[model samples]
Target: MKRSWWKIACVVLLVYTVVGGLLLPVPALRQLQETIRNLYFHVCMWMAMMTVFTVSVVNSIKYLRQLDLRRDIQASEYATTGVVLGLLGYATGIIWASYTWADPNNPAYASFGSIVREPKLIGTAMALLIYFAYFVLRSSITDMDKKARVSAVYNIFAYAMLFPSIWIIPRLVPSLHPGQEGNPALNVNDVDARMRLVFYPAIIGWTLLAVWITSLNVRLAFIKEKNWLNAH
Candidate 1:
């Protein structure tokens, strides 16, 4: 029961999010309409991705402080999981965009060129590429200690760059994404009071789910490493 509590919470919260998110009434606005429901799912994925990445960075920092290879594994697994969630988020965002933001009727919405040029998209891609390179770096090194130490250092540097690439640079460039000039979807007047209830839980639920997935990856990595050490 102790180990299962959070997992139970995860399932319950997500079930609520899916059921209530789809059925909940939202403020009708120009351009958004029924598509606003996607905020619960699509937006939560990105939010959860960020949360997982933050945890990965913290684990990397811990590995550096303690020189613990297990911590390094934790860092790598969490980061890889974060990247997976980010990819999923990006895919869902594209689907959502095609329906509403990319609609031909909306002057601001662009289906193709704008998507490629969008600052957020570009930055997000860059961030994912950096993390992907981390794995490549790890695999190329043969020494376990060297791999752990160098990867932990590189992880910190990559995470530092990630903040600027995904968060800062995107804000400087022109973006159709919300929060540019005060997001209406986030504004209390623009979003209904009821949506906030589901929105917050959805974020927590998605984040917890991401953490759960990361835990599985971390355990598998640990077992593989342990077996390799025993074999040698």
Candidate 2:
């Protein structure tokens, strides 16, 4: 029996992520406990969101360079996938924060409001808003050609803002979110070897999943357009 490469790869990654997470040594496990397990989902979601957004911006650039409708469709699909993943990632992070910061009964916790006000959280919200505006801008235009062109240009601007809004500004401000203001979580040295084993593969798995979804979205969009064109 021949196994599908993608299926095989996904199974291997799932096993590795789960087993590596379970096998962490006592001291390391104590430092993170069960909360550390959230790393697999939380980190991977963000990584996948970033990958999708990157592709969206790249296709936007290509559309601008060539003024091609196909590229525009690709960019739209990618952006839609990115937004969905970004929202999911934010939701997961909120859950993680609620567990670590909002539950007073937990000794290691802080306050929910404090986490909400964190710079990273604010910046991430702003980034998502910017992308959301891209969809709005696209929808407002009736001319297909003009819509694609304008969206392509808007995508370029939105992509430019993404880095500073999501990455740089967050790090510059003092915050509880990891990897900010010299937070040790940014350091590879800070993550135990066992965590690394799951963390890296989780990134790859989630990114691939995001790509697969985006491709399906693009295909669907193409089919929809074809149907519309035939009807008209």
Candidate 3:
């Protein structure tokens, strides 16, 4: 029970987030309106993506240091989970933007063109693409140790690129996305104190879920590679 306490908490907090995010009153901000409710899902999922990617990079560094195949497997699974979360975050963000940022006079396609051009969106796309290339790089190598070492190095590079791609360049340019001045969703000035009740918990819940999924994947990989792992 003690070992599984976080899994329980993940379920509970996600339930609370869904209910509270929909029902709770939000600050009446210009343009955002009721769509501000997406804060719990869209922003939280990005936070979860960032969290998982950080874990992935850390494990990659561990594998590089110790040359452990198990650590390499852990890193790969976590990166896979992070990519999934990033895609979810991207989906939610576009959905929210379609409703909130799209011009009423413009056709859907035209509005989508504008949304796609947004600096923040472009930056995020770049970041996701870099990670996608990481997987492709891994697949190109057939030798196990070479694959692991090369991918680990590339994973670290991908992590470093994330700052410039998603964080720095986006903030430097004018963007339709919020938090141009600082961390998105973290600005106490922009986000209502009331929303934080669900927002913070949502971040935790989503990240815990990512970690849980990665753990299962890691264990499965370990099982599949058990003979080879033992031989090494």
* Cα lDDT for residue 152, candidate 3: 96
Q: What is the TM-score of each candidate against the true structure?
A: 0.89, 0.84, 0.95
Q: Model 3, range 113-155, lDDT digits (tens) per residue?
A: 7678777677667767877898899999999999999999999
Model 3 vs. true fold: TM: 0.95
What C-alpha lDDT values do all the predictions have?
0.81, 0.76, 0.87
Q: Which candidate, 1 or 2, would have the higher TM-score against the true structure?
A: 1
Candidate 2 RMSD to the correct structure: 3.7
> Where in model 1 is the C-alpha error above 4 Å?
103-110, 181-190, 228-232
Candidate 2 stretches with Cα past 4 Å from truth are 1-8, 18-31, 103-110, 181-186, 227-232
For residues 75-157, what per-residue lDDT tens digits would candidate 1 score against the true structure? Answer: 88988988998899898888788876675775644458777677767766876888899899999999887998898888889
Model 1, C-alpha of 218: deviation from truth (Å): 1.3
- Kindly give the number of clashing pairs for every candidate: 0, 0, 0
Error in Å for residue 66 of model 1 = 1.3
lDDT of model 1 at residue 207? 93
- Model 2, residue 161: distance off in Å is 2.1
TM-score-based ranking: 3, 1, 2
After superposition, the stretches of candidate 3 with alpha carbons farther than 4 Å from their true spots are none
